[model samples]
Target: MDKFDKKILSSLHENARISYAELARRVNLSAPAIADRIEKLERTGVITGYHAQIDPTKAGLPILCMIELTVKHLDYYVVLERIRNMPQVLECASITGTSGLMMKVAVDTMPSLQTLIAQLMQFGDTKTSIIIDMPVPPRMPQLLADD
Candidate 1:
C-alpha cells in the first residue's frame, strides 16, 4: 500500500469511528479521497473489521484465568480447535514454550473456572493462574503507523 493508505489505517486503528474529515486532516488527504482509500482497504481485506474493547467483569464475567496446556504430542491442532469452540475460552493461542496452548477464560466465579479446568483436563495436563490485577494490558499502538 501507499503512504496515504498507511496513514489512513494508522488513524483508524487509533480510533475506528474517527470522522472522515478528521482522518483526511491527519493523513493530509481530502475527505472523498480518504473515503475511497478506506473503501479500497476494506475491499482488499487490509481493514478486515472494527471492534470495541469492553470489560469482562461488567459483562457478567467476573473471573479470568490463564490456562497453560501441555499435550501428549505436537499434533494437537484438533485439541486446539475443540478448545476454541468453548464459550469459556475467550482467547487461545499456540505459544512458543512449554504450553501447547495458552488460553484466557472468562467466567462468573472461581467455581466456573474450576468447571472449565475440568473440561480442559480431557485434552492434556493443565496449569492455571488467576488474574490478580492488570495494571496495564500490553495494548501497544496496535495500529501500524506509516514508516
Candidate 2:
C-alpha cells in the first residue's frame, strides 16, 4: 500500500463510517478515487468487514474472564468446536506454552460462568481469571504517516 492508501486506512480505522468525500479530503484524493482505493482494499482483504463495538456490560454480559486450557492430546478439534459454538465464548486462541488453548468469555451471572467452566473441564484442565479492568483498550494497527 502507498502513502495515500495508508492515510485512507488510518482514517477508516479511526472511523469506518466516514464518507468517501470526507475520506478523499483527508487523503488528498478525489471522492471517486478514494472509493476505488477502498474497493481495492476490500477485494485484497486488507480491509475486512466492519463492525460496531459494543460494551459488554451494557449488552447484559457484565462478567468477563479468560480461560487457559491444557488438552490431553493434539486431537483437540472437537474441544475447539464445542468452545467455538458457545455464545459465552467471545474469543479463543491456540496458544503456546503449557496451555493448548486460551479463551475470553463473558456471561451474565456467576452461576452461568461456573456452569460454563464445568462444561469446559470435560475437555481439559482449565485455569480461569476474572478480568477486573482493561487499562489499555484494544486499538487498530498504527499506519505510517504519509509523506
lDDT scores in order: 0.85, 0.91
Q: What would the TM-score be for candidate 2 when compared with the true structure?
A: 0.92
- What are the models' TM-scores? 0.82, 0.92
Q: Model 2: runs farther than 4 Å from truth? A: 144-147
lDDT of 2 at 40: 99
Give stretches of model 1 more than 4 Å off.
1-3, 138-147
lDDT of 2 by residue, 1-147 (tens): 899898888888888899999999999999999999999999999999887887897899999999998987865988888888999999999999999999999999999999999999998899999999999887878765646
- Candidate 2 backbone overlaps, count: 0
Among these predictions, the greatest TM-score belongs to 2
Q: Write the per-residue lDDT of candidate 1 for residues 1-147, one digit (tens) a residue.
A: 888887787777778999999998898889999999999999999988988877898999988889999876754977877887899888888888888889988999888888889888888999999898899874535545446
Pairs clashing within candidate 1: none
lDDT for 53 (candidate 1): 79
